[model samples]
Target: EPEVTQTPSHQVTQMGQEVILRCVPISNHLYFYWYRQILGQKVEFLVSFYNNEISEKSEIFDDQFSVERPDGSNFTLKIRSTKLEDSAMYFCASSYRMGGELFFGEGSRLTVL
Candidate 1:
């Protein structure tokens, strides 16, 4: 089965610093997304990308947050300024079509101090 892949499984950053999280979705998938789960909290959607543009985004995706598929394969999330509340496990996911079951990557854990 095809799966999403993420790099730098763990990251530690200071407050106000920038961090970039990376992911590679399944080869044939067209829709990609980013989600994050804070410790002891439910997972929350951040953004969804399709057709090289943002299809959906949550309130949590503020000016400090951004996503891109720079090389058309690797999907990336960049946090312009990390905050203590930004600490969470970030998951990348992909789907063959809209509203379909998503294939997720092993999460990237971010710890902000």
Candidate 2:
């Protein structure tokens, strides 16, 4: 089965630094999503993209954050200015159906120091 892939399985960055988390979603999937978990907290939706535009986004996707499909297969989330609160396990997910059965990547762990 095709799977979503993320880079820098673990990342440690200073509180004010910029970071870009990368993911390559399944080639045949039509919807892509980003979700994050803060240690023990519930997973939160960050954004969803389809047809080359953002379909939905949560409040957590603030002005300091941006997402893009840099290429046909690569999707990325850029945090221009990171905060301690930004430390979380960022997961990239994809689904063929839209009712929300998301298949997630192993996740990129971001640690803000």
Maximum-lDDT candidate: 1
Tens digits of per-residue lDDT for model 2, 24-81: 9888887999999999999999999998899999999989889899888898999999
Off by over 4 Å in 2: none
| Candidate 1 TM-score to native | 0.97
lDDT of each: 0.96, 0.92
In model 2, the clashing pairs are: none
- Give the Å error, residue 55, model 1: 0.8
Could you give me the TM-score of model 2 versus the true structure?
Answer: 0.94
Q: Per-candidate TM vs. native?
A: 0.97, 0.94
